[model samples]
Each structure stands twice: as C-alpha cells, then as structure tokens.
Target: MRNHSGHDQADHEGHGGAQPGGLSVSEHGYTLEFDSTILTAGVQPVSFRVIGPDGQAVTEFLSEHDRELHFIAVRRDTAGFQHVHPVMDEKGTWSVELALEPGDWRFFTDIHPVGHDGTMTLGIDVAVAGPYDPRPLPEATGIAHIGEYTVALDGELLPGEPSELTLTVSRNGRPVADLQPYLAAYGHLVALRVGDLGYLHVHPEGEPGDGATAPGPGIAFMAVAPTAGTYRLYLDFQHNDVVRTAEFTVRTATAAPKHAERHHGHHAHH
Candidate 1:
C-alpha cells in the first residue's frame, strides 16, 4: 500500500479532526491552486493563498478556536475522500503531500477567526487542465434566511439523481454581488449529505454579486447522495465591512443521481 498525506499529522489529533471551537470553512471562496502532482515527498509541496476583505490574511490556523485550515476533498463521483490539513508554508501557500488520482476533484476550505464571527472562505475545482467555472447556477426556489450571513434554503433531495441547489447570497437584506475576493476565490459553498455528514464542495461559476445586481440566485455545484439523508448546508461570503454566514439543513432529492460513496464525521453544531 502507498502512503498519502491528504491531511497532516496534526489534523488527526484530539477531537477526531473536526473540532468544536475553531476554523471549519464557515464561508465560501477559499481559493485552492497548485500542481495536482506532488513532485517530491518532502520538498516539492503544494502552494496557494487565502485573503480577507479587510486586507488581512485568513490563515488556516485557528488556535484561539481550534484547527487551522479545515479542508475537504471529494471527487466528482465522491469516491476519493480526503480530510487533511495543508500546512501553511507562506502567506497563502498551504502545502501537503497527497498524491491524487487523475480525476476531477473539488476543494473547499472552512476558515474562521479565533474568538470572532469572521469566517472567510472559497472553493476550487482541480482538473489536469482548463479554467474554472460553473456554467449555470442551480435554480433557487423556496429561499429563506435562517439567520447566518445571507439566505437559508428549503429544497428537496433524492438518492441517485443529479440535483441542483440554488443559493441566494446578500448582505443587509440586499444582493451582494460585488463581493470582494474572500479567502482567494469569489464565494464558497459546502453541502453535506444530511445524516452521515457527507461532504460536497460547491463553487460559484462566475464572479461574486455586484452591488448593482443581486449577489446570487447563485447555483451551488450539483451532487447526488448515495443514500437518502438529511443534509446540513453552510455558506460563507464577505462584502462591505462584515463577513456573513448563512446556514440551513436540506434533504437530498429523491431523484438525485447515483454517485460514489464517501463518509465524513458529524456536523459541528455551533
């Protein structure tokens, strides 16, 4: 068997990787960029950065809280799953020694400030080649705000069917398109298959919402749950002078397509 370092040694510590009070990718748009191939086991490492709106750095380390950068990697088919912590070598260059199989994979980072409500984020798709994208957004139907940063969602879910999760993001009760580069990407979206806490990393196709236009009606990346489960959804976005956290619980569609089976830990019910 080959040894891979999807997550670091520190990641598998005290609280089963997912901690109670720490950084857990609360927001969306934590940028993930690097050569998928790790040239050296010890030297040739991965590189990337995450910036905050206040012109500060949103680090993976949340000592005042808990874990540093909480990263979740799941293949499009949900077959390959990695819950690893990339060591921040530089400003935003988080490095890890995980050899990934040739396939389309998505990376979502949960970032937060210790002792504060500032949770910044981003998501990126890793292909051997090509620019990133989200062609069309999932259509948002019964939208509600359960008091996070923006809107809360009320939708349907099914097993073995492709389902779209339409999301609307805004601040101060208005569309927040012109959302600045939070973390390193535009916006961030994370979807967990309800009960078992399966992970889905969803990214915005286009730039964030402009103050002129509505922030979203931004569709989240699509996914299908292996088994019917109650999913919890969390989104992180930043604009103006504040960072917003929008959260909700959703059930996968009954007609949801069939994807690979991936397992995850319990939700950190903050």
Candidate 2:
C-alpha cells in the first residue's frame, strides 16, 4: 500500500501546491468553470468545463477507468450522492442532468489531462434555490440497504493507515455471484470525509478477469483515511447490467499506543 502522507504530499506539489482534492475549484493550472452556479430545485441540466493552463477549455484527456472523466455530485451535508458521467462536446464543455434537491451541492470532476502527471479532482459548489432543510448525517454503520440488495461491510478504518475493506452484496438473502464488470472492475468505491468532503476515488483490489479475483459477493479495496474522522463511502456495483450504489457511513478507529509496556510499569509502581 502507498503511504497516505507521501501520496498527499506528492499531490500537493503536483497540483501547484493546492489543497487536497474536492476542496478547491482550481488546481495547478486547470480550473472548473461552470456555466452557472444557481439553479432551480429539481432535475436540471448543468454544464461546465475544465479550463487548462493555456486559458482554453481542455479538449484532450487520457481515459481513466474506461472514461476520460468521472463526475460526482453530493450535497454539502454528505447526502444525495450521485455518480454520473458527463458528455463533453467538441468545444470541451461537458453537460449532464442532475436530480438536485433544495440544498447546497458540491460537484466534483475526476479527470486526467493529457500531459498531467496524475489524475486531479476539482470541485465546485452550486446552490439550488428553495427552502433548504439539511438532514443530519446518518449514524455510522456497517450495513446499508439499497432497494432489494443489502450490502454488508466487513472492515475497520484506522487513522493514517491503509486498511482493507470488504463489501459483500446480497439480494433477498442470497449472494450475488454473477456480478457484472463496471468500469473494468467488479466495483468502484468513492470515499469522502464528512466535514470537508475530501475525495478519494478507490478501485477494487483486483480486476474482473483476473484469475485470483472472484466475481461473487465480496469486493475488496484498500483505503487510507487522511485522519481520524467520520467519512461517507459510496460503492457502485453492477449486476444484471444495471449499476447501483450502496452508501455507508464509517468512522476511523484510533490506533493504540506503542509504549504500552512502559505505561503499565508506571501504573504498577504507583
């Protein structure tokens, strides 16, 4: 596993010393320029573009995860998460329709420019004008139910450490073994820290055709929490040719002290 700190440091430097992903609208020399930042509450079309350093909308991009770009939309309170791909025009403007409610929304674009070193996630906030009533975040849990499917999470997140997370999918108490490949994998996981919505786009441990990886009920991923905090996880899996997302609220576990023997000795003496 790659060290979180080291990876973050490299990202910081590579993105012209900007803050982490999903925290800024502009990074390095690219900017997320939206056509409008205010919209009506409901399903509406939104348009935006990634303006490159040359002051033009970027038209050339390298595909990542079977697409040139990935778009994510979530409310400010970490509710109403939607992962959708936008259709980019020849002029570099991308458009997509989103089912937005009466609240503040954050839109993130995960993209890799042709000459960029790595992928970059850029975020912008939009306001849907209406009577906004923010809902409290759901309590931390290991299980989430989506329609007829139930996803059970079996793993613990340790602060600043790479942890293995396995999510098993079942429908009506039966394991789903004939899972279809989505984005070249059995699943795609996106982790966002609660307060700041720090974005982490994580892929599954193994590919779909790999001999060791099973297509069945369990999808594994290695995720690193930047700190000890509450985070919201979204898992997009495909079955029966339809993509569905399972959401979970997870809190990082604090690591134990390393000098336990010395501390016990002091207490015994006392």
Candidate 3:
C-alpha cells in the first residue's frame, strides 16, 4: 500500500527490502562499524567503516548524488540533525568532523556499493560524554522558523496512502522566488518516525529547472506513511550560497477502512 505521499510502504523503511535501516549497526549482510562508539562534545573527529559480507571493509562504492556515502547524525531527542559527506580513506574508513552536543546520538549511513544490489542505509548509536539533558520534542506544527527564512508546511500525512506535502518558503513576509539548488535538488528532505527514529524516504516531486518546478515559494515532496504516528521532518535548502535546515513535527492520520474488501467478503450467505 501507499502512504499519504504516494510512496510505497517499503519506502518508509529503506531501499531493497522491507527491513528498516538505522535500527541496527548490521543489516542485510553489511555492518556499520565505528572506531569509537563513545565521543566527546564539540567539533571532533569521527571515523567508521562499512563491513561487507566477506567480513572486510568496503573501500569502493558507487556514488549517489555525487557522494559515495551520505552520513546523517542526530541527537536522540530529535535535535541536532546534520547531513554530511565524510571522506573515505584507502582502507575504506570514512571520517568526518561533527559538532556534537552532550547527549546520545544516532548515525545513519546511506551508501551503495559497486557490487551491491541496491542502496543500503545502516544505523548505529553513539554516546557523547559529559553532562546530559534531553530535550522534549517540539509540538506538532506546520510552520517552522529558522534564521531569516520561514517555512510553512502544508499537507496532512495519511496512513496507507500517498500524500503530497508542500513546503512554502518566505523571508520577512516576502515569498522567496529564487532558491538555489542543494544536493542536486531544490531541497533535500529527511524524515524520521518519532518513537524509533525510523528513517523515511521522502522524495522530492521535482527538481530545479525541471520545466515545471519553480525555484522558490514552494517545494513539493511525496511520501507514504507506513503507520499512524508522529514524525519529524527536516528540509535542507540552499539560498544565496548558504544552506539552512527547517524542521517540522507532523502526525499522520489513521488508515482508512477497506469498505470494499469488507463488502466483497460479506456474500449474504445465501
């Protein structure tokens, strides 16, 4: 079945199968191993590698959107989300610098190996040492204000159906008409379910200069809700050579009843 965004049920999980990513460090024959599971606060060095089925580090990978691996780090309480690309060494060890706060964090690695069947998104958790305090998730809202831009999310997430979600961008009450491309698209969207931080695949409806897609004012995305629950969405967009992220908390509606199926099965026992 499709979710409100018209995407397949599997899309809410990860690609290539029904299993979800970021739930475990090892999944579907590939393992996400890190040099250290414990890190310190501040801008620090973080390194990890992907172990293939042969029990060795995978050094070669097919680039996706100009990057071999896309690393996403977020605090456990739905805070501090960063989407970045780490540099891989000759030994397949990937390292990147992240400004981390004191708390538990989860890392998601999205990659595609040259010989692998499809893209793999692996998840692992790391601990940040020091005093820790968790932040409560923000209440559900359609509008997200960050920096000089204000983004208003318009759409409802319905379970087991395809839904169209549009995010409108404005600055100081004026519509933004020129949104620069970021990561090969006008915007990059990442969604995670609230409870488990389950990764959801949110697809952009169109790309920049795609003949019908406008660069500004509104960016459309399509996704399907796998279930009824609250989800956090982060949208990254570039404008005037700088990239910024807008986050939103959304809840999906319960799945619609299948009246037709019920009726079909009720054959009046004649």
Compare the candidates by lDDT and give the number of the best one: 2
Q: What's the CA error at residue 3 for candidate 2, in Å?
A: 14
Better of 1 and 2 by TM-score: 2
Whole-model Cα lDDT of every candidate shown, in order: 0.46, 0.82, 0.80
* Residues 1-270 of candidate 2: C-alpha lDDT, one tens digit per residue: 211122432244212133247788998899999999998988889999999999999999888778888999999998889999999999999999999998888999988898887778899999989999999999999999989999999988766555779999999999998899998789988888888888877777778787988996999887667677898999999998899999999998886334545677899999
Give the total clashing residue pairs for model 2.
0
Q: Sorted by TM-score, highest first, which candidate order results?
A: 2, 3, 1
Give the number of colliding residue pairs in candidate 3: 13
What does the lDDT read for residue 199 in candidate 2?
80
**Deviation (Å) of 218 in candidate 2:** 0.4
- Mind giving the per-residue lDDT tens digits that candidate 1 earns over 1-270? 000112321232111123211123323333334545222222234555665445445554463123576666544444344545677755656766455555565565655544434433345666533333422322334454635445645345555443555566654576655665654334455555532344544454433333433344454444343456565455666566555556555655554233322211223332
Q: Measured by TM-score, how close is model 3 to the native structure?
A: 0.88
lDDT of 3: 0.80
Clash pairs for candidate 2: none
Among all windows of 10 consecutive residues in model 3, the one with the lowest summed lDDT is 1-10
Q: Estimate each model's TM-score.
A: 0.39, 0.88, 0.88
